[model samples]
Target: MNYGMVFLSIISNRFFDLLDVLNKLNELKLFTLFINIKEILLDLRIPKSKQMRTLEQWFEEYAVSHQNPKNKAIHYVCVPAIFFSIVGLLMSIPSGFIANTLKLNAPIIENWAVVVLLFVLVFYIRLSVAMAIKIAIFSAICLVANYYIGQVFPLWIFSIGVFVIAWIGQFYGHNIEGKKPSFLKDLQFLMIGPAWVVENLFSKK
Candidate 1:
């Protein structure tokens, strides 16, 4: 008898719940961090290209060269290791010039790895907001781990070792798959590789 009123009440409650979440993000000063490329495109009045692809499209293309079970298993380990090693190498670079030029002094923000991660985050944000958030969390962990590991060993040397070893593992995996790595065809696939791994891992759960 009062179906219309019940529907309105449910909608009202959901609207307020969303507002509460937004407020929490604001309180944490992370509201801006969650922005995506669609918002940026809209702000600049730019239209998406007809040829532009979605995240899943990139994943599909990447999967074409990674079909073997052995290759997939190797990627499960090496892709992340390569990413972490790259970040570690960047972290090892001196950031005094960058910090001085920007007049910024915070240890975290002054890091070369942290600076590069911002651009990396933007790349993921263009693909998907959820993916970007996942990557951002993982990037933070890499920074923390590199900081501690550096105190015990030379960061650049350690990063170089990991990088070389991980690539060796990757080449071995591709030999099993009998196909060239996708990144050889398109350099952007290097970025797609990590996102593809993260997307598959999360989808399994």
Candidate 2:
């Protein structure tokens, strides 16, 4: 894939993964709820029929190949969740710090900008209405988190440091897997990462 596509995949994968972890932590008992939320997301995106069937078959095979339902589910959820959480946490630190240092008089406006950017990103990925709504909810949560974190930290230092650290963690995860990352093949795979995890979770039921 092109460099821009790769970059988008990387960022999108990381973002959705972060949302997965945050959602999990916030509502462990409501895992199925998240699955329903994901279904809504899928509805909005309108994935290709052939690709959808292929993905479903691939996931079923993947689940069986692992031989442990729990492990499979954990793999689906934890890998992306941890990878993306680090990314989000890293990026947010710097963003938060920068806004603080600049004395951005209108934090709300900045947060709205971030939300709008997220919507654009999701749109670019061609997410469905349901998926868009889920992402909007996550973006809203991230904004609140960003505002609070910005109030507490210095932006430039936080941004650079977080980027470095999170990237290292990401590479480490890939190293263990010993495979070129999925986004390298298809940029849309980035959006699929979160839905894939949610699919695995629901597949168990």
Best by lDDT: 1
TM-score for all models, in order of appearance: 0.72, 0.44
Candidate 2 local Cα displacement, residue 162, angstroms? 2.9
Give me the runs in candidate 1 sitting further than 4 Å from their true place: 1-51, 101-106
The residue-level lDDT of candidate 2 at 37 comes to 97
lDDT of 2: 0.54
lDDT string, candidate 2, 81-152, tens digits: 443343345444324654666677656444334644465456524535554555455555655555566578
Residues 1-205 of candidate 1 have per-residue lDDT tens digits of 7999999999999999999998998998785655765578667652355137789898998999999999999998999999999999998899888888887566555789988999999988988998999998889889889988998999999999999999999999999999999989877799898898898788665
* Cα lDDT, all candidates: 0.88, 0.54
Which segments of model 2 are wrong by more than 4 Å? 1-106, 109-118, 121-125, 194-204
Give per-model CA RMSD. Answer: 16.5, 23.1
Residue 12 lDDT, candidate 1, scale 0-100: 100
Model 1 poorest ten-residue lDDT run: 42-51
